[model samples]
Target: MGRPRVRFTGRTEADAEAVLAAAAAHDACLSGAPADWEIPAGCAA
Candidate 1:
């Protein structure tokens, strides 16, 4: 079976970008990424 998928629908582009940024930060923290890691351009929205 395929892995379950999760989708986020924000009311606006800005909202969606905020959600994506938060998710990226959370992921980085969990993975013990370097504090100076830069957010990808796409993820910057």
Candidate 2:
């Protein structure tokens, strides 16, 4: 199977940051392999 694809729309920069932060926290709680969650290079936040 292929990786999941998600697109966040109608959200401000802060909202996007919050989503990323939540994902990080969830990963920490699970203590599992970290997912590739990051802003793409050269993309303005």
lDDT of each: 0.49, 0.48
Task: Find the candidate with the highest lDDT and give its number.
Answer: 1
TM-score of each: 0.36, 0.36
Which runs of model 1 end up more than 4 angstroms from their true locations?
1-14, 31-45
Q: How close is candidate 1 to the true structure, as a TM-score?
A: 0.36
lDDT of 2 by residue, 1-45 (tens): 433544445666757666676555445443332354444322224
Per-residue lDDT tens digits of candidate 1, residues 1-45? 432232344346756665577556656554434344455444443
Question: How many angstroms is residue 9 displaced in model 1 relative to the true structure, after the best TM-score fit?
Answer: 11
Clash count list over all predictions:
0, 0
Extract clashing residue pairs from model 2. Answer: none
Clashing pairs in 1: none
Regions of model 2 farther than 4 Å from truth? 1-14, 31-45
